[model samples]
Target: MKLNILSGLIAAALLVSGAARAATQLITEEEAKLPPPKGAVATDRRGILRGPKVEFVSPGDSVSSPMRLQLKFESFGGAKIDPESVKVIFLRTPNVDLTPRVKPFVQADGINMQDAELPPGDYTMRVDIKDSDGRPGTAIFTLKVAPK
Candidate 1:
């Protein structure tokens, strides 16, 4: 189904912020290390979780300057999952800093994100999404704001 234009913008933002889990939100990696996509992973291991697809869409290396962008998310390939169950989050972690900037965007059925504007900078992003049945999926992304 075709979603609203802002929906695309939100998806792009989520994509840019890969650290944000697809439908789940958390700060420390410890939480991220847990089993994901609900029933998809019966065991806990450090790797990709299977479920909804999340992608970062802007402020890429190609960017020459600071700009405001949105994160994007899409659901598919799961076993009869509901978009409403998905959760979206954006976490900013720096290289030297042990603590990451944690930001919760939104949670909804199909897609979730924020309308806030951000300046240029390098940030480690995370997106988390969980199915209604408890399945969880998360994605990691990097955003480099270049001299545009």
Candidate 2:
């Protein structure tokens, strides 16, 4: 019994180590193609938005429950973004009518920040923004939260 347990532990360790190495390798490959500092465009299921580089900083690409998601974005266009037109809401749930728990605010530097605490569930967080000229764009970020 002791030998079997020892072998299982070793196998588990090896599996975990291999998975970590694979993840690290993927990150390095993605880092090479990261968008430029300025004039970056985010394109996802909701179409494309020129300029206004969007970056999801928190809750990471994937997260567990009881997580706080953070977003930071910049606008590089002719018209100023309408603060009232900024919204973050859930997607693909019929009759859910759920919106982000936290209200987003724009900093003086023209960057928009949104943070929200979420429960355990799969979420499609979609952010919509429109400029004063009524030019609109949407950014989609996927979140998976495991039950804690």
Please list the Cα RMSD from the true structure of every candidate, rounded to 1 decimal place: 14.1, 15.9
What lDDT score goes with residue 53 in model 2? Answer: 47
Model 2: lDDT of residue 28 = 20
The reply for model 2, stretches above 4 Å from the true place, is 1-53, 95-100, 104-115
lDDT of each: 0.44, 0.51
- For all predicted structures, in order, the TM-scores are 0.40, 0.51
Model 2 RMSD to the real structure?
A: 15.9
lDDT of 1: 0.44
lDDT, candidate 2, residue 121?
54
- TM-score of candidate 1 relative to the true fold: 0.40
Candidate 2 — what's its lDDT?
Answer: 0.51
lDDT per residue (tens digit) for residues 39-78 in model 1: 3222232453555555666544644332434556555555
